[model samples]
Target: MGGALVVYESMFGNTRAVAEAVATGMARVAPGDAVDVIEVGTAPALAAVDADLLVIGAPTHAFGLSRPTTRSDAAARTGTGVLSTTIGVREWLEHAGAPAALPADGATPARRGLPAAVFDTRVLRRNLPGHAADAIARRLRQLGLSLVTEPATFTVDGYTGPLLPGELDRARAWGEYLATLLRALPLLPEDAGATGARGRTETPGTGRSAPRTGRPASGTGPSAPGSPR
Candidate 1:
């Protein structure tokens, strides 16, 4: 009966579309479970997060996550079409404080470090390097959130793109996969580490390695294209 929250940063709305699709897929798989999607600008603080699972998405800028300067550049390119200009995922994570300590009364806490997944939208080009998803995964790990899956990438036709065909479908499928995985795993204690109290690996069922650093292990891609808007 756990819920999920999907938080995203978008320049031209492609990432927002993917975030919604992911939530849609999760809802379809677990209709009775709560699934919420939110823009990163308005996302709750880390200490305020109340979900059993967390999903983050953003656009790839330069070679990684967007900085204020990059976001400003994107805003200039779009005029008024940019979805978020003030704060991107990178800044949000940078300011994220650790979760509030558990209640001292031994009562169940509102939430604990969660199982998280990350995805990014990038140009659909072969052998292209850099993934915001990878960087996001690393930061979430540093915050002690266990990754349920490797970072994922969705491709746009270009820089401010309409996502390539099937990318939304792929995102939805990934969301469903994540929901399934969460449902299959046993819930752990609030203070458990990435490996869970039972010593099971972070990615149960899936054989993917939950490496702390390096490039994302799996993804879909496309070259820079038109904006979804």
Candidate 2:
């Protein structure tokens, strides 16, 4: 295989560790494929650059996705304002000028149409919030990426989680599986190198509308769409 990328956002470092395990699994299964793991905040904005697969993961926050920082209307225990919608932390950042902030990064490598998957570590107060995973998978699929397991979930005891004992193994298993699957796909068309169309589609997690014509309106603030498949 040519290459693959794993982009992740983690709070307690468990998720980052899990990402490393996942990458190792990928390398194990696909000996020649290139795998790069980076924190979401530091990862160059990745869009249309194509890879054989991409796996996105994070921690669950208040029935949604987590972020390193937040702007909730009301203060929360995490120190960021709570975002009370279907939107997640990354989407919020997207609407919060993620593009202009990337003055130094060239177009990110695309992983369109590959076998993409998503996961999250959530406090087990409830079964596990699914939207965070769906939100990530939906973003990948909007680029026509294939999905594995409608995204998956990893668990822990409280809001700030260590993801139980074996979740990192699970993540690695997922990465290995995805890498094996990606071997079947062809290289991207030469033209699919730039960022894929930056518009929203009917995300499965929330039928919440994508930004009108690929752009968020002023003050709308990026939020995850409410629950859906």
Candidate 2 lDDT over 21-84, as tens digits, reads 8799789987877898867655544554356566677765555665444424222545543223
Error of 2 at 59 (Å): 1.1
Clash counts for the predictions, in order:
13, 16
Positional deviation of 216 in candidate 1, in angstroms? Answer: 15
Residue 198 CA error for candidate 2 (Å)?
24
- TM-scores of all models? 0.76, 0.61
Candidate whose TM-score is highest: 1
Query: Which 10 successive residues of model 1 have the least lDDT summed?
Result: 220-229
Per-model lDDT: 0.69, 0.51
Q: Mark the regions of model 1 whose C-alpha exceeds 4 Å error after superposition.
A: 98-112, 187-229
RMSD of each: 9.0, 11.5
